[model samples]
Target chain A: MNAGHRSESVPNASRLRIAVLAGGVGGAKFVRGLRQVAPEATISVITNTGDDLWLAGVRVCPDLDSIMYALAGVNDAERGWGRAGESERVSAELAAYGAGWPWFTLGDLDLGTHLARTSWLREGATLTEATARLAARWDLGVSLLPMSDDPVETHVVTEQGTMHFEEWWVRHRAALPALAFEQVGADRARPTPSVLGALASADAVLLAPSNPVVSIGTILGVPGLRDAVVSSSARIVGVSPIIGGAAVRGMAAQCLAAVDVDVSAAAVARHYGARVDGGLLDGWLVDTVDSAVVPELDSEGMRAVARPLYLSSLEQSAAIARDALAVALG
Target chain B: MNAGHRSESVPNASRLRIAVLAGGVGGAKFVRGLRQVAPEATISVITNTGDDLWLAGVRVCPDLDSIMYALAGVNDAERGWGRAGESERVSAELAAYGAGWPWFTLGDLDLGTHLARTSWLREGATLTEATARLAARWDLGVSLLPMSDDPVETHVVTEQGTMHFEEWWVRHRAALPALAFEQVGADRARPTPSVLGALASADAVLLAPSNPVVSIGTILGVPGLRDAVVSSSARIVGVSPIIGGAAVRGMAAQCLAAVDVDVSAAAVARHYGARVDGGLLDGWLVDTVDSAVVPELDSEGMRAVARPLYLSSLEQSAAIARDALAVALG
Candidate 1:
């Protein structure tokens, strides 16, 4: 075994309550792999609702469902969005009614999630409750959670105008250069008790290869969340969403620039420097191509491990996860 | 013109700014026919929001959308509920999660309306504003007004337990014999000013063939809406939802029974009654089968007009509307 490998055996499946901070696409892929490798782990995903917006009155939680669908084994692998057999007739009708923001194809089946969540939220339920109810519907083995019960919108302050994350990402195709990334209502949003409790009790915390700026960043933006994760006994590890230089999906590079972080694995590690520096990462996993950044990441106090984080196959992805756990318990 | 028809040189279109008090299904169909006959004339449908409920946090307005879809030319003709070309994948998923009542089949596209309305309400918009925004999206020319912006739910007190209108309508299929009908929050629900204005400014007023006890009756149940309609200068007319001894749609007869009204068109007329001992109905239209009850209605101080009120076709429905107008004007 490598020097980073630990002597402690992995936690039992039924007793393990692993919490993951996730975005979409990359995160969903990693989650699928995680579920395959650790089927018994009671996974709790604190998803980024920053990308969530009221599009024509439906509470569209893209990231949450991406993970939910991945867990439910119904996610669309081709588009990397929505369910595999999803229909868009409802979305087309929504477009016809001039509800706008048609770039995001809300499939008819996917719309069920939004409709249920929206309805629950309207009936005095928090976003947390709505999300839990939706997750329960899919019989999702792991608990799915919104980072905060309160509204915390991710505003991409572009040169053109301050627009919602969906407007910036989907509608505008993230074409406009972002001036800054603002997490609106972050100060007021409280970290869900479940998220905090999971952090406190977790033996290991995994940061899925979600967008560091908008996805994971938004979750950390919830006032007490970052602190809770940092102060926890759980060893923190993150898989770089950036494989080499470009993001797997979304404008992660642009988001990194807006947040004043360099678009490199080493910079991402340093950005999430140490669990002590308001950064929740202690172990950082980078792709083989970005192995050159190991020295810099180690210099910043994170145990840097170079592994194939491309997640091209479920086995490859699980191997990388095993590597992350190894480094965390070194 | 027939002897019952009040022949005049009055331009039908000019005198057709019809204000309709409605619930769902039957009410919507009459409004549909009304729109077909007088598309150019301003039609303002004041729907009963007393039947409105926040299920799973989505603000579902059965009457509002029923009328809106009917006017927008997309109501489901066969099922007599929701929009045409609708999908219930969302409802199915909700059921799978053990979430909201699933019997109603809230269509995916239709759920979008509720989502948007609920989201707007979350962002601090009243039901009126949300409904206006929703109608604007459909580009509906007819003014669709909620009886009250405040939350007013229609509750059916049955032997088993009191349940929401949607629960009673959808879950039980109105099977439970209702002990009484209660419009919850009606005492607190003051009618919107727009409703009174529409009623006063309307050239003619029509009550769609909705249930007198729970549909139109629910709207009239709002604190001041019934009083405004009763006192309005506009000529009032009502089409019978009940033809012979059976209702065109829904459990209108059962609802009438709950309110101690008989199941005949004449009974419907008497339910509206004479305003001060004989005043509420200026004119009442009954089907050919109920012609025997017309003399009884006239004796009770209600102007009764016998016509073929079974609205089987667009043209036939408009003919009934014309006859009702003729009687009201006489």
Candidate 2:
């Protein structure tokens, strides 16, 4: 993927209501930029719960926290996860007690949120309710709705046997060749009312350039979430996490390989397919490095366009957001 | 009361087995000294469980932790509680969420212990079992056993209504004018087998200079605990937290007032009364300033001795421990 920094800043429409599907780092950065460009727009994010897990008697939602911290401006911008100025005293102790993933380090500040959420959950509050209470502490401009209130864990089946997605990603660094990716409880989970409402009432639905096989893929795996996006009156557009023949970030290349898809922008668009041909995408935005496939994607009725997709700064990211909105609103 | 630290350092017998009933700061200090004096003795501390409470979804035993930290050499000596080299970032965040005691702050290093203990308890470990798991992490010289495995909270009844003991002692600084002391659920609680066995087999039993009204009193209130102490053949001795007409530290004077006991060494001894007179104490160690009551206590069939009761230093505390042991062993 070429990390060229070149793009024409486009003017955006005012106050357009939009819903976004997101995962962790990449999604957080994209949404932060999207909010920068459309500061007055009513934004709703449907976060994937597939990465949530019970560790040390506390429920940790990686994607949910990543997005929350990024939006609140308390996120570690350099590290791309957890709160800024965090200490690992509690996590170090937890590891000493052999209670959690040693590799999955949770900073003390992040642990506070987990501990508070666990308290609510233990006292019978659903995931959605607990998240609301946590979100209330921050002035996150957008409403964050989990894809479902129910527990849905993504697992990777490797030759070494199946493990939680975090263990595969964080612990193993996806070194173990995965046989399959399964959203363990997604078959029983339904989209929360807020998620459905966000999709139904939005003018446009955007998918952040997160790993499709695990993040967005896992969110859509929730029983009724994909159907709701497909049925929504909003035009559904996606930004390719991949540029050229590799992932922009994370272990998406390995995930794509495991799922038997070529690590290319074209393969991913076809994976989402065209909404006109009974798939998810109405428009697909690819980075300029992968512009050669734009016409083929357009000819396939997907209405593809290419632009510089490097999120090197807030301004650059906002420019990409403007282009996505322009194409969706066109 | 006696500013002069005048006491003969009595030689302790090697490996004398003893059991101690203790509470927070005073108890922790005394135990640390006791371990120093009798380095090879089998010491088991039956910590007051009434100070235990559920805070932010985690079961926190202040007494157990205090003793454990003290014995492990990790206790904060300056403030007399929590760990040394602590941080409060997580605690500040928890307060922002409105989830825990705003006044009683838990340091991040201490929070690590709480989180691990909570994990064990949630996984079906009994309070006793959870405590054992925590104790295993430290090289604590003495065994810190909770008085009982049940949820026995000490609540203070006041004009402002009833509140947890920590709220009264820590938050309000015991200023609410407590009407009565309550050991809630102690009636349904049974001391663990370890606690009973420790008392049954010990060469002597000790009441640390913790607040008699709430600390030692709460342990004695546990169902069958007082009976075990009285029935044990071991000579039971008590070191007065009260000296002259004042408590050594803490809000013991307020607690003593709540229990209608005059804040004097003689008064607390009378409150426990003489074991021969169907009460708990067989021997009592009062400060040299309160030596005037010794003859009267001796005549009442309870051996009374006076020593410097202030635990101002490790050497001073060890001298007090040696004096208490001498009186019991006589």
Q: Could you tell me the TM-score of chain A in candidate 2?
A: 0.94
* lDDT value, residue A126 of candidate 2: 84
lDDT for each residue of candidate 1 in B1-330, tens digit (9 for 90 to 100): 112222322255645667888887777667666665565677788988877876765678888988788767788877777888887777787777666766666787787777667657877888888789888866566788998888898899999999988788888889999889888888888888888888888877888888888888888888878778887787788888888888878889789888888898877887887654745777788888889988988887777788897767766766776676666555
Instruction: Give all candidate RMSDs, comma-separated.
Output: 4.5, 4.1
Off by over 4 Å in 2: A1-15, B1-15
Steric collisions counted per model: 16, 0
Q: Which residue segments of model 1 deviate by more than 4 Å?
A: A1-19, A40-46, A100-102, A122-130, A137-145, A274-282, A295-301, B1-12, B35-40, B119-133, B136-142, B275-278
Candidate 2 structure lDDT: 0.86
Give the Cα lDDT of each candidate. 0.78, 0.86
Residue A270 displacement (Å), model 2: 1.5
lDDT of 2 by residue, B176-247 (tens): 999999989988999899999999999999999998988899999988999999989999999999998998
Q: Tens-digit lDDT track for model 1 on A1-330?
A: 111222223456457667788887777778766665566677788788888887766688888888888877798877778898888776676566555366877887787787677767877789888777777656566778888888889998877889998888888877888899888888888998988988888877999887888999889889989888887787999989888887866789988998798888877777777775666788899988999988877877787888888878766766776676666655
